[model samples]
Target chain A: MDVILNFIAENLPMITILTLATFVGIEIIAKVPTVLHTPLMSGSNAISGVVVIGAILLIRDAKPDEYLTLIIGFLGIALAMINVVGGFAVTNRMLEMFKKKKK
Target chain B: MERHITDFLYLISIVVFIFGMKGLSSPATARKGNLTAAAGMGLAILIALFSPAEGSFDNHIWIIAGMVVGSAIGLVSAKRVAMTKMPEMVSLFNGLGGATAMLIGFIELKNYQPAVISTVKSLLSNGEAANLMNGEVFSSIFALIIGAVSFSGSLIAWGKLNGSLRDNIKLPAPQIVNLVTLTAIIALSVMIMNGEEMNFALLLILTVLGLFYGVAFVSPIGGGDMPVVISLLNSFTGVGAAVAGLIYGNNIMIIGGILVGASGTILTVLMCEAMNRSLISVIIGGLGSSGSSSGSDREEVVKEATPADLAIQLKYSERVVIVPGYGLAVAQAQHVCHELEQSLEAEGVDVKYAIHPVAGRMPGHMNVLLAESDVDYDKLMELEPANDAFNNTDVVLVIGANDVVNPAAKTDTGSPIYGMPILDVEQAKNVIVFKRSMSTGYAGIQNPLFFGERTKMLFGDAKASLGKLKEELNNA
Candidate 1:
């Protein structure tokens, strides 16, 4: 229990940020109308691809001899890139249709 | 100093993301919102590449290769995928994101070798290092479990959406099996957390169990419930990414992931509410699995109509509303439907579309299809307004829709879909439904609307019927 408290004390700032961000997320998303749910979903799906930073850091910090770790990191970067690119492109495509219709 | 700059940029990305999301609240700013979010992502990626590294950047080639290959595939698929297959494509991308998070977590845990040794040493002393190590390990395990589940569950959902997998796969005592698996996973995770050394085999086993739980969780869910499943899995991927952020101490990832997680959760709830089902019932599956039972015993009196009759009725009507469903997509008839609407409008009839929230495979699916065919956005009416207009509507042409317009939802208390909100099509003066046969809808229940006092069934494929209706309208 002491150990857990010490860890929380050290990372209190990050935890607080995350906790507050959750409410902001809910507030912003609740206002979106149903007509844009698909685009909203895909757009946020793209945002979650920010994990690519983690993958890049992993690859950056790996030793040359760590072939297995490097391979895994490579796969991580590739998959995350796919998610980010595909999600945004598909969302744009859907929204473009909506745009043309409005005109 | 360099680390501070990168962190500042990440904060900027978070703010941009918020504004982008806010812009999606209406149709007018939606396209710009998507573009702004993409720019933010691009800025973040560029900043990440040049950010401070603990070690010299040795894997630049691999990173660039991965980005190029992934971009090519993403662009090609996004450009070529038919709008009707949007649900499956989104599911596939979400699964990829989950798989990426799982892989990152696995590497993070495996690379914590130095921390393990120090943790053991600190355990014999004051245990300062042990606390930090434990926190990192906890985040890694959380990300791994959630990511693995999202990955496999979303793949199953994608398969079901694309019709590559069967609608529902019945497992023997699935609930019990899932409960056991979940308990085992929790037990294993706790053991790993409390252990002094890294248990690689146990971690592997935990990942496998998570993947197994995902398949079991989604196997029994009917296809009609896929939107809820997909939304839930999307949130799982988001939460997994947020946990990965925790492990890496990346604020951008934490905020971005939390936003997606919250968005997905809201969408899941909205989908369930549209069908008047709770999230628990959706997860338990089997809502529409049974054959038609309640209204099957009664004599079904269905009225039949021809394309000419519908054409004549639509021509004389002052107002017409079309309710479209998944069948419209399957028949690839949105363009023809649009053409028919135009011909009716040429005769001075007011034409509009009534879109149920859960009309197609996903939310806003019918709107996307109608928009793709160049339908005016102003003519699309949501449920409440459409219901109000139905009272004054001269004719309601239900194209390939069944459950949404089913009067049983409002009147038949014993019906499977009772208490669900449905379009008030029965209140309109005339109703014409385009269907293939007397077969039940996705819910596997009989729609009493087919036998209503004013209902008429034009039995044929939706595309053929719409084409014939267009020809007849032009001839008249």
Candidate 2:
């Protein structure tokens, strides 16, 4: 009801930012051709690893009695870590293969 | 003041991410771009962890344990994985992102459990708790559902890639079941949004159904469609993370997630065009699964050539194009393929690599393989330009590639790959293919280029054949 409406009104700025970001993303990606697609996919996947920030935010808010929350937070951090670390590592490895020849 | 600093860092990270993606668009700067984006993520994590306005970690052991274990998994797996196994690894990483977001939603729910229960019970009694059904609550639930689907769907994709899953989980009218499950999720979500009374059990049902929806969505897909499925699942992870970010008021999270979501979506659309198939037809799966267009109409006499013969023709040719596909990756033949190019180059023959969009297990897979072999970046030509080059080309050497060069894509409307954007190898002056057998490609579509008048089939393992061919050309 009014709560939902107020929530939307308060977050209108974030929503607008997200929409604009998506358009910008589409514009940038449209310029990348097929040969660069794999790197593009892996690189963007690495970027979304920003969710580790969300994991940290939730974990810090947890109290001692909220064990389930604590454990979920830890696991969430671990998964986000994997996405961030593995994604960047893999993308780098793939990108290294695309180096210009020295000669 | 501390919060302001942290918010400022998030803004900078967003900019870095955009610049990183821009750098990745070109081959020369891609590695630097990846490192830059990684630095951005690292800064964002540091700010969130230490900012005084944000909640601080009380248990050092738990947080440290998560970081150490997660970093070990990421570092070890990424280094040790072979280039051929890149697709499943990408799927695994994407799945983890989705799973992380899902768990965060669950953690948020744990914090709100008592209040949620009381509010729902109050709503059942027609009280004022309906106001509790706000955006955060909706976003948390959205994260829960979307994250579950992305996680489970990626696992299935991994299994399919590794061949653990025996077949597509085909039941009669899976489309109906998929439709029903989707409708149920929407109906339940709306009910919760409208503040209809519900329980944790109802939420549990929704979670299970969401997971089921993922399984159903991808279970029927196999073969050439795997790339599209992987890209779709990748976008699902991004969407899940974006919703979770909405709940947490994390601006960088939203920006990063949207970028990923939008890129994945665009990639899928581009792939559909490369295959000349609509998105709807792609979702139906079983595509190109007609079982390798093989053993059909062998009336034409297929010419054969040995490495010695190929050496003679390529050594004298003025222009040569080499098209490599999944077979090249499977046989680990890129090094030799590059050597062959260098040998041909020494003879003053213009040698270039023709790359088809879906040539390997993933999009742009051949580029990675060729580039790894230290082939010059300028030598790789994409399908359209490569096709145009074929008209003036003296010879096209195909290494373990079939689908991309099949002339049926252009001439035979009755073929499964009739409309696919194949490399115009048939238009070249001479064609020589290296393979282990007359086997059809992953699409099970037979390549007419194999049997065309000018084609010379040199049957052997791609690596062995390329090695022998390189040796022959070197000596000549």
Candidate 3:
């Protein structure tokens, strides 16, 4: 308990930014008319796929005793990779149609 | 040595990402925006993989293997995915994201030094040692629980949407169970907060239970309610990512996670408005099976119109409104619908599409369908504007859309969708409904709107009907 509070007290600024970002994100998302809501969902979903970076970073720092971390990191890498590659690919497929409208 | 340069690169990537999102909002620049976002992602990943801080990855082959296997699966499935199955694809892909986040937290729990005095003799008094374990513990465990829920819950939703789950699995008093499970998780969090030694063993067990908790949470939700469920689970993955971001203190991950979480939540709110239901009611979920609404059982006379007759209706109409529903998605008639719209427009008849907020599977389901068929974004109208346009619309050609255009949603107090907002196609001068059968919508309630004097029903396959109309109109 004390450790958490102390950490929060130290990183208060970063925590505040995260909190603020969440609210600001909601405001921006709410402004998106429902017409584009599906793309919005998929686009943001692609963003969540960014966790692959965290997995890669973890693998780079793996210690000898961190065998479980290694296995989990392997799985994370694979899964997150799917999200990143598939999400971007699908969203791009949908978005390209919109560009055709311009022509 | 690489940390400073990598951080600078990360900064550049984040700036580009922000610009990409801004450009994504409009149709004209959306493709460019998607490419720009991909470039930023490329920059971020290149730094992480090739120029990461600290020690380099030891197992190059395993990393490459994971990448290859995952890419093959994602690419093949995405390529083979039909437009009709896009909802399931989105749900399943989002689940993978959640599962990955959960695994990161899982393996992270192993990084904690074993809880023994002999093993940690040097850290027996070291505040730094305790702080390291305590600091990451909360976020780590938190991500495990939520991500597990998202993974399992989304898989179940995908099954249901694809017709693999035929029945809405009923759980008696699910709210009670959901409440109990939630409270237990909170108590568990409090334990972590108060420094209960942070056991990985207990968290692993809790994660298993959390997986079940997701199934428990979603199974009771009725069939018609899957859109909200899918959206909510999509947000759950984002929240999981957000927690993962905190563990690594990565700015782009943090920003990305928050962006997804907030956007999904807003989309859920919009869905609630479109359904004319409260968020609480939707979450409670099992009410869809109540089967309690009492009304007319006798079949009413429906005015049937043939394709040639419908073509004639379109030829003379001054303003035409096209309401695309889920059936349109199933029939894959969006291309044909757009073809018909153009034929009408060239003849100087103004044509627009009416899109209910919850019309198809997702908020933008109808739009994507129409856009894929190259329908201009300017022609798509929302609920309010659609209803407004209907007032002056000479004919509303409802293609496989039933519940959204049903008048009972407004006038019939006993209707299941009463108090729900609906497209007032009932107000249009002439309403032509195209559907497969006289059956009710997913709501299962017989729509009196079908029996209304001004409404005419065209029964057949939506795509074929549109094909015939397109052919006839083109020849004219």
Candidate 4:
């Protein structure tokens, strides 16, 4: 109990940001029409690729002799980059088709 | 100073993501919205590379090489994938995201020894090693479990979507097994967190259990419920990423992950509602397993129609509504369907598409397929509007669609898909369904809509049938 309280007190600001962001997320997403659901899903799936940042940090902070951690971190970076790049590219492709119908 | 700059940029990225999502609320701005979000992601990645860190941060070559290889693979696959196979592609990419999160958690645990030792040393004087737990460590375990589950679950979903995995993989008492695995994982996680030493072996066991639970969780679900599963897994990946963010106190990751998580949850609920099932029932699986036995006993006479007949009826009709499903994509007939629509339109007939929310393998799957064939976006009508329009519609062409238009959903309470919303094609003056045979739909339930007096079945491949119709219409 004391440990949880200490952790909460130390990270209050980040927690607040997360709470507010959740509300904002629901509000924005609830308005997306059914026609765009696929793109909405794929686009947000891309956003979740923000873990690429964590992968970068993992590699940046690894010790010199920690080859195992380094390999794991490298794979993390590569896989995360795949998610980010592939997600966005595929979303763009789908959206482009939607865009062409406008003309 | 560097920290403040990084934080500020991340905040900016968050704002951009919000705007991007807001732009996706309608079709007019959806493409731009996606592009804006991609730009935000790029900005976040660039900022992360230059952000302050404790270690050497000198692994530039490794990072660049990884990015190059990953981007090449991503770009090529994105270009090569057919529009019909989009659901599989999305599932694969989502699995990659989940895998990345799991790896991050693994690496964080590997480097957690120093923190554990220091905390233990500080607590030795107090003789309370149990109180040595902190949020960073807790968040890492959370990420590990959720990420591992999402990763394996999504791969199974992808395999199912692409036909590489069979739909009916029987497990002996699956629910019980899943429950036990979940309980064990939770118990192991708590033990690792509260234990005196960092137990890497126990952590490995927990991860393996999580992965097994994911496979067990998704294996029993029928294919018709895949959209909900995919959406739920997408949210799992998002929540995992958010927890990873919590571990590092990264604002962009927190906000971005939360947004995806929220959106994916909404989509999951929407899909379940479309099918008239509760979230729990969908997760329990087996809705469509016994469908063939219950609905296959009917021996009603089916009326057949030729492509030439359909073409003429369609030509003389005033308003035509086309309902497309997964079969259309399987036959690769979207372009031919579009050609038929254009030919009918040239005859002064009004052509509109009625798109059920769960028409294909994923949400809005049919809309994307038709859009790829250059169909006008204005012509696609959603469920409610399409239902209303059916009252005035002169003809409905159900091309390779089944359950979405099944009248049994309205009349047969004993039907597996009872209470689910349907296209109400029976309300129209004439109905024509294009299929290869009288076989059941993805749900394996008989559609009485096929036997209705107003309905006519045109038996052939959707592409060849539609092509013949187009030729007939042109020659007429």
Candidate 5:
């Protein structure tokens, strides 16, 4: 009984969040109408930017023995930063796609 | 208290991000997507700034400063850039991702220190000393290489989209060079893994090689194949992020990366389908500029009919269909198209806009473009529904669109885009095309729609011509 409780205590956060997020993602995919995909995708891409903050956090807290951890965290932050910036840029460009052409 | 605040901010940012993603799934809410995403980013920044960290402050400051500078550049580009250059903008954005990954990787590698340092006596006596390496160096180096490759590759894609790369018959040597670069990168990865000390010099060299490989990979690819390349590179960025996440064991990084990777891959496939080209054929650089109907040929063939004549034609017609394409997008003439519909309806003529599934560059691209100009949703018809209607239609108006209206797809068995679905504009009684010139679409194939006898070319810019039609119809 103690072992099971310990397992639940250890795994609860990840398990609960993952299950909920996955379920929500699936539900959104199914229930949401197609007309909203454009903004939703852009929003999702923007949300993905949190990975950068996570990276920054890890880099700051990284221990000496965790040199590799810092690097990985840094990398994640950098890539996420790129995604956030690029995704916004692309979205902006896509918006202008219907703008009038100059003669 | 501060830590709790930071975590709360982080959680809120994450929720905003998810909300923004959900908002992006449709055209109606696309504009809102930008604001939602910007808010999420703002939240992320807040979290980063306030959150407690164990590392150097100076680096974080630099990162923050970089974000400000990058955002300024992006804002300026957004305001000043033309619509035609949107694809190039996507390429540039992709380049940012590539470059950022590369920079982060390079920085981590530079700051990297081994877990243990041997004594000076051990180094001198044996003339060899090993420093214990860790996962940080590996992740950093990996990101750098991947990012460098993405940056260069995306730049080339931008160049192609902007017509700077120029259309030409080219060799496949660049692909071979890319293959060589890949092998070297892999070998270098293995070397690094074998407890090698920080080799900044080697990494610098690899970075240069990867940059050259990016240019080489995209240079030979024709404009017709760019959307596929863009999508492919998008997938690469996601994969790079996923790799970085694995290196860090961050739950959010892993989740976000997987989401990007999976969606990007699916989008790449969808984009390839829109081009009516196989993903493999695009990778191999399928004949981008093999066929040519010269500008002079267009000059010789095109005869502009006044809107009065078009109006008269419409008056006599039993049924009329309008095919909206990228030309309509370039002209921003959906409103005028709507006006044309009203005019036709007044004449007791049946009019409908036939939208091909792959009409514009992306899926439902025509619909979104039209929607922005406030075209009625009811008037817009998808390929299948519109195709069924075309058989009885008396006239088909082919706007600035090319590939979608091409009859070659339906009739030409030997064509590269033989099996792709296309608008059956050829079945209509009379086809009137409004175009600036007879340029092929991204597929690099000349549209047979232009050459058909029933097709009358009204040579001009899409918006101007549509505006002209509106004026002429009103006068009538």
Candidate 6:
């Protein structure tokens, strides 16, 4: 019981915050109009980029003793960077589809 | 103490993200999605500051500068970007998720090595092996390889969707190579688990192999299968987040990731169903191949009709219904379509738009494009509602839409898009199709709407054709 309590105490803050955020997000999702869904989904994906940011920070902050953590952080940052750049690139490409011929 | 603040902000950001997504689900509330997402992101950054991780204002100054510059470019481009390119925009969005996953994973891996070794040394001196294992080593290394694959795979999907990657060209023998590389990656993953005596060389080889597999895996898929690919990539992003959450012991990441993965999977299946294709076929498929190539390239099939001829029919008709498709978007003819509707309404003819669910690349795409042209929201009826209006209408004017109005859906079983629900434009008394030429839809199948007895083909640019008809309508 003491061990479980200690475990919960250490990680409780991040957990509670994330849970609340998720609840709120779900609430908003429930009300979303049909026509706006695709764009909304796309935008959400863009915002979820916090994961990349987190990974990069983790890498930069890695203690010399934590080699595995360092490697994982680097991997996360790299992938997230790709997502950010490629996402923007793909979005630009998509927007081009809408360019009208100027008469 | 600082952790509380981080927790509050992270939770707030996640909620905001959800709300933004919800608002985007419907066209009626789409405008709000952008704001909601932005707020969520703002909250997320704020939360990140209070995290257990150390942060100095100086280090973040560069990030702030980058945001400002990025925002300027994003704002300008978003404003200037045409609605027709929305699918590509969606593809790009999916790419971001994949890329982010890969980056985070990589960062995690790179950071773990030294942390593990030091912890191990400390444990050895103190004779505590378990203490070193629980800290960061395993999680970080695992994240790196997974993240790399996600990043490369997403870019390939984006390329395929944007036409930078062609599905028409099947890379033969690549499938076998992909299989072999995948097997090797699995083996490497096992090798990675063999203590923290870091093998950088093996990891590098594995990354290259995974990269090659990612490209080959996504290359053979045609442009038509992009939506499903995007959905799959979305799931991958979710999984990445979940993994990241696990590494950091963040519960929100786990929950959010699971939800995203589940929803994205469902969405992928729905999109596949919409295209009348299976997930397996899409993943390992090539369109514009085995299907109907008989009439697709036939030049003599193009039928030209003047606006005067269409005007004659419209002048006599009591009711007219306009069905818009991707072609209208391509021509930027929504304004013209609205103009045509207004003129028809002025002449005592009832004008309504029959909107298909998946018409014009995305759901409610036609609605947004038409709305931009000042078309009335009430006049635009959904597939079921508009189908009712079609029965009573005298003339069905299908502008720049093919398969949606095709009679072949009713008769052709051999066609890939046979069972898909389509607007029964052919059933109308008089049907006129304004088009550039006889072209297949996204499914790459010829529409039999052209061959319909009542259907008359008016071949030309959709916008120009609509403008000409508008001119004739005014004269009439």
Ranking by lDDT: 4, 1, 2, 3, 5, 6
Task: Go through the candidates in order and give the C-alpha RMSD of each one to the true structure.
Answer: 2.8, 3.7, 3.6, 2.8, 7.6, 6.2
For model 4, state the Cα shift of residue B285 in Å.
3.9
Q: Per-residue lDDT for B172 in model 6?
A: 78
Note the B-chain TM-score for every model.
0.93, 0.89, 0.88, 0.93, 0.84, 0.84
lDDT of 2 by residue, B1-476 (tens): 76567779889988988888878776667788889889888887777777675334456566667878888889889999888888888988988988887777665653454234332112122134453365666787788888888888888888887768737466567678889999999887776555544466666777888888888888877667788888888887888878888877778888888888888888888888888887787786555544344446657667889998889888899999999988899899999888888888888999899999998878998888887889887898887899889989988888888877878778877677778888888888998888889877776677778888888899999999999988898887
How many residue pairs clash in all the candidates, one count each?
A: 0, 6, 0, 0, 29, 79
Which regions in candidate 4 have their CA more than 4 angstroms from the true location? B114-132, B290-295
Which docking band does candidate 4 fall into?
Answer: medium
Candidate 3: list runs displaced more than 4 Å.
A1-4, A63-68, B1-4, B55-57, B114-133, B166-168, B188-201, B345-349, B469-476
Off by over 4 Å in 2: A1-7, A100-103, B53-57, B114-128, B163-171, B191-198, B289-301
lDDT of 3 by residue, B131-179 (tens): 3345466677778887889999988888888878747566678888888
User: Candidate 4 residues A1-103, lDDT tens each?
Assistant: 8776766677788788888888888888776678888888888888888888888777766666678877887788788888888888998999899888777
Write model 1 residue lDDT over A10-92, tens digit each, in one string: 67887888888888878887866888888888788877787887777677777777888788888888888888898889999
Better of 4 and 6 by DockQ: 4
Q: What does candidate 4's lDDT look like per residue over B131-184, in tens digits?
A: 326676788888888899999999999988887786656678888988998899
In terms of DockQ, the best-performing candidate is 4
Q: Whole-model Cα lDDT per candidate?
A: 0.83, 0.79, 0.76, 0.84, 0.61, 0.60
Candidate 1 structure quality by residue, lDDT tens digits, B1-476: 77678889999988888888778656788778877888888887777777775445557777777788777788888889999899898899898889888888887776665343432122222244543246678788888889899999989888888777765466788789889999999999888877766788988898899888889888778646788888889988988988888876778888888888887798789889988989998886556654454666887688999988778989999999999998899899999999999999999999999999888888899989999999988899999999999989999999888888888888887776778899999889999999999987877788888888999999999999999999999998
**Least accurate stretch of 10 residues (summed lDDT) in model 6 chain B?**
B119-128
- The C-alpha TM-scores of every prediction are 0.94, 0.90, 0.89, 0.95, 0.78, 0.79
lDDT of 6 by residue, B183-208 (tens): 88788766754545556676567667
lDDT of 2 by residue, A12-56 (tens): 788798889889888887877677888888888877777777787
CA shift of B438, model 4, Å: 2.1
| Prediction 5 TM-score vs. true | 0.78
TM-score, structure 6 vs. true? 0.79
